[model samples]
Target: MTETATAPAGGLPEAVFDPERLAAVAASGLLDTPAEGTFDDLAELALAITGAQKAFFTVADGRRSFWKAAIGLDAGAVRENDIRDSPCHILIGTGLPLIAEDAVNDPRIRDLAAVGALGIGAWAGYPVVSPEGHVLGGFCVVDQDARPFTPGQTRALQTLARSVSSEIALRQALRQARAAGDASAALARTLQDSLLPPRLAEAPGMDAAAAHLAADATGEAGSNVVGDFYDLFHTRGKNWAAVMGDVCGKGVDAAKVTALARYTVRAEAGQHTHPSVVLHRLHQALAAQRVSDRYLTAALASFRPAADGVGVVGRYASAGHPPALIRRADGSVEELDAPGTLLHPDLPPAQDALKDTTFRLFPGDALLLYTDGITEARDRERGPLFGDARLARTLAATRGWDAARTVDHLRRAVREHSGGHAVDDTALMLLRVAGGPA
Candidate 1:
């Protein structure tokens, strides 16, 4: 199909040509880029489910629609064309999906020259948005015959579109963060915060809370950006996940691995019910790309509210990380005994060492996941490290406490133990089952 006029069409919104939105499109790095497997997979899935004749994952600049991935289109077909010639521009203008079940007679674009040239009987496009909420382009499907899409198909297409948005946003965020390496503590804090969940996902029948105490809590200049990250999120169905990890080094290198570990676990946790499998998948991802020589230790748990409503039941795995702790409602603490090797691409045999065990959190009981920073804190005189024994004793003293209070209590204890000078960053997540005894 030949290119069309560059001006906005009659029904298209003028915002499609906004300068900032166009800038976001440029920053997306999707325009004119080589095809990517992720985008290709999205296009393939879109076509598979919709039974569409063709699919396109595209990015649009002011004048041209650049195809990032296309399926069912011949190699000689135009890969880039005037933005006005494609319905994706309508999605950009409206910031919404453009679905034309009968594109040949669809008033919005039937008059366009390319519609007849491409023989589009039906068309559906979902906006691929930027992190800042700008419409960068779209994931669209085209059919040779007019077809009505079911609600289920529409929802699936929307989900796939969101995955595309997430992939782009993550790449953009990490690029910006790595580019800011060793720049400023304020920037370091911002970059570190980006690696963590903005807030913990609400857990059914449980109280969830988390905190990160930076090694440089004093707000001093030139503090190393250590890799201590934690996340609490809901996986598929009734399943929920909690993870805590510490990368081997500091600064942008650590941040890169931290981002990778967090994203990989998130992408895999929904597919697997076992933490060990999720963690092993993470290992494979890390091994596939040696971003750095740095290795990391992680604790991952997948749990769900019990059918009896008495507590939570799930399995947790440890990879050369400290054990997770359970503080019973009666004020006694029990240590978990799952240990495995640290995560490094080169440590294939260590995968066998990874172990996961079933556990339950009864009402009034709390589950604690933490990095070693808390246990390794020393006093101002650099005396004995705070150690696991003290942590257990302290946790046992916080009986009947909610997750929030438990986490706060531990943070204060660590701060005082270290005389307000932590040698490393500390991260903690606690989930307390409801209806605990007073």
Candidate 2:
């Protein structure tokens, strides 16, 4: 029989804890996990169906209710709420649907957080049951104003709660579905795309070109996202900065570090004249926040336009990252002599290794910043890498090309080198000074 109750008939469900119910909640594994679009979509659907301003898919862990999915909550809202403060405290153990026609006056829950801090005047919820008949969590609808749930509406919501339970099951299976490459790869790619900038911004007096592609193009494994990333931004003092970096590993772990490094560098961009200063800031930030051995190497360069406007001068720093190269108007290639200290909390003296190199870019000179993935791409899965010499030749041949053409040319060359499949994550950024001698 379907269980429905407006309020607890007994003292309360949590005066005592049930081990079996808590175990089912733990097995669901929905607490404190990464937010996924699948859950967001379901929450959205729930909001529309109930015509409620907010909907939350949550699991109660005895002391607090953890929201796995929520819509209409502020960005800074805490995801967990104290059980004593929430009306859902009693809902957790009962396994019965709750419909408070006037929650603000409902003696059973009027003193809860739903009515006070949250200002929620009315609410309805359905138990989320697994196939084994364990109530894993509950789906809830909330409103700031008074409202009531009809019998038909409550039944519809019950069905949706079951869907949410199934989604949790699907995601758990997907996590363990590493042997099935396609599903995990799709999820990884979704996360990777979210971390990457959709497109590079256009910097004045420069032509910018950028590209990113997955390493496992053949889909032989899940987690195809790679460690390479690039950025172009206008900094303070009428200058522009170009950044290229590679995290130490691949997939989700590397992507996490990539996101941290990119945002930290961008945060310090406008304040520094030399790239080394920014790298130092990121080094300290990561050192204080990190618990693992993860680190990334970065190449940072700041460009200030010359008064003549015919070219620009670049001040660069390298932290164990690949050295950037310049292709002059006459097609000669020179690698900038930037210091190559790797950023790590383990090395206290490496900051001095961060030397700044200054170079003049006369009109028609192109600067190329890239991650090692490009030069190290293998033609076959286990073949020789496409090393530095080949990259030099490719740059020399592209001297006759523009900024965009140079990037396109390199992409084609890499494709040829890797036989159209990348053996590692790859990224490239090309910046050409606006003019070349006619």
Candidate 3:
């Protein structure tokens, strides 16, 4: 339940509670449990310190009052009150301790037969609160005669109540952390489904397929979604464009930037003919956003259908990203060297030194582009990473397969190498030039 505190009267310190903290407190699985030895010890100590006939830990969960632990009282009998309607409700509502000298004479307690039945004429109670400032319950003491508690006794009980509050607060914090983790997982799943295309666009005289798999772990919820994206589209002139890249960082921020990069590449490819020029325009557009400490690593390739053979020409740029893999039809795999500095780096000269590389795709040749997540995945024992050499060997083994099958095999190999532990988000795109006599 949400609660707001009013300023204390007569210059006394005010008691405050936070609504969110209370929600978290309610989420803890500790409420309404049978009395245990640890709590009984606490109540016993409280009664001894306050010199009261009985002391108890009472929790009110909207419906009934439950005694989680009690001393000098029957555990079963303490469950008889509708605490929401009790005279003591005012004390809890105000988040202040209440002390009554004579319940028989005090109009507020006179009608409370439960207290008279127990032969109690005096009482004192302090509210227990979670760290986020939600009221969880109360710690209370009672006597059979009309008597005022000493200042020292009241202070001691207040201190003990604070201890109970701290316990509640700890439980609340754990619950909130778990909830946030669950929410982040759900968000990552949604982002992956919405951002990545289901299938690649078909190209004439060439075969292409792409697959993207985000790491199952590493975010606010233990799964980071990296800014990696890929796209395939056909231009007005019937030329096919395929692009793949990775953006810096991970999580929601990186995911947003990844989406922007994907669209930027597609839009520019539609407007520009040259793959190098399209990447240049994309860099300018992304740089214009003024994103702090952000940049993209990209590769753009165009394919045109030929009467005798398919022609594939591509230009790739790296902004602090790993190189791509090229697999020949003859079972040879090599890494393409595309050297460029990260965008928005601390040093302007390093950014200016960035350059692109152009390559021609021979018949039966394939190009593979991916995010660092695939290369940086750790082994089963969390030891060395699955480096580029392993990836090259895997690609070489699958060189004779179709583009779709090649991508599938590579994905399986990466998963196996990492022992199913994908610590970073990964994206992979494959383009194959069909074989025929020129």
Candidate 4:
């Protein structure tokens, strides 16, 4: 392979070869990832806008040219080649578009192999620049016929190139945002996992599954997920306890509150037999800690096995949290409406120290307990909340599914309604009797 003879047109300064442009191209993280339709689509539009036969969008890093998109050429056909042998070098070296009206006659790039070997008669291309004014490559259209490009056609090509530049710039911003978000999500996930039970202990009478959603999800990847936690632990005489809650705030403070609530529940549920007593104990613990400007909202359910029967009875209670929803085997849905006070002193005292709502879960029945973040999540920024009705409808549809499937279906529904990310922390706990009616 012979490198073609080349020279810097228009007395280009040596500063143009500073190598920073190559680093900028790499920093955008757009090279060699995948051929996105975004760039290809833009090239197609450029082809139509310029009335040319073919179009290409590329990224050049001073050393070589790599095609990001190609309309008529095979994929990876122009992946790498010397800068001088390629027409794109004209744009990179001159910092201006190369509008070769007639490549066979135009001295600018006539001797280049792009014209001599490929028979490309005309080229109307502009630079695809980065946000920092680095020339990445060319968004160009080519023709097999020798023809002159009108000034209007040339201007339109420049405008389309600007649009391509804007798109490339957007990708760079998204890459940076995801990087920062990933860092935050990693730490938050570690903290969140540490605060939660490693796994929900298998109960004697039911199948259990749980999923948590943090408000930190900004892109396809998530970050800085909020403080929502749950636990299913066996406690006291052939029974199990289910705990789900949200801390008053987010990050480390909210994580601390989550840990305090879970441990307090675990410590107290063993000594006690009633739901209200456990909640009352939790309220006392939070109050005594004096976690300034912080409190927790929670729900606890204790399941008691029926003597030689096909079902279990559950006693449920909550402190300033959303009521639980249950889907019966017969496809009936009901809410365990327990009015419990938020831990703050300004709210009504925990009535009867947070009353319990006892519900029966027979074979093929499911009990779902979740934090308000699920229902309170909005369709868009400041949009209406997903609300209780939607959740009930979602549960009604997942009547006979097992715990894992039920939680998955409900999570998908919430994500669809909230445009794929919760604005607050979301925690879902689904517990179902394992088999069909015994």
- Estimated TM-score for each candidate: 0.67, 0.58, 0.53, 0.55
The lDDT, on a scale of 0 to 1, for candidate 4 is: 0.72
Please identify model 4 stretches exceeding 4 Å from their true place.
1-185, 218-224, 345-351
Ranking by lDDT: 1, 4, 2, 3
Q: What CA RMSD would you report for each candidate? A: 9.2, 17.0, 22.1, 24.7
The sequence of per-residue lDDT tens digits that candidate 2 reaches over residues 1-438 is 234555556554752256766776787777787667777776787788778888888887766778888788897788878766766765665656777768888877887766777778788887665423456667888878888777666645665665565455444444544544646566556545544566777777787888776777455533546467788876654788889988775556665566556656654565568788788867765564352356678999898888776688879999899888898888889887586677765667456678888988877888888988888888766687777878877898876578777888888888887888776777888888777853
lDDT of 3 by residue, 160-203 (tens): 66555544433443345455674665555555544566567777
- Number of clashes found in candidate 1: 1
Query: Which regions of candidate 1 deviate over 4 angstroms?
Result: 1-184, 217-223
Worst 10 residues of 1 by lDDT: 1-10
User: lDDT of all predictions, in order shown?
Assistant: 0.80, 0.72, 0.65, 0.72
Query: Relative to the unseen true structure, what is the C-alpha lDDT of residue 23 in candidate 4, on a scale of 0 to 100?
Result: 77
Best by TM-score: 1
TM-score of model number 1: 0.67
Candidate 3 stretches with Cα past 4 Å from truth are 1-182, 218-221, 291-293, 306-310, 345-354, 436-438
Please identify model 2 stretches exceeding 4 Å from their true place: 1-182, 218-224, 381-383
**Residues 127-180, candidate 1, lDDT per residue (tens digit)?**
787655578888888899999987667656765676677677657766776677
lDDT of 4 by residue, 6-117 (tens): 3355543343366878777887677776678877887787777678887878777665667777787766464555556678877776565677767888787787766865
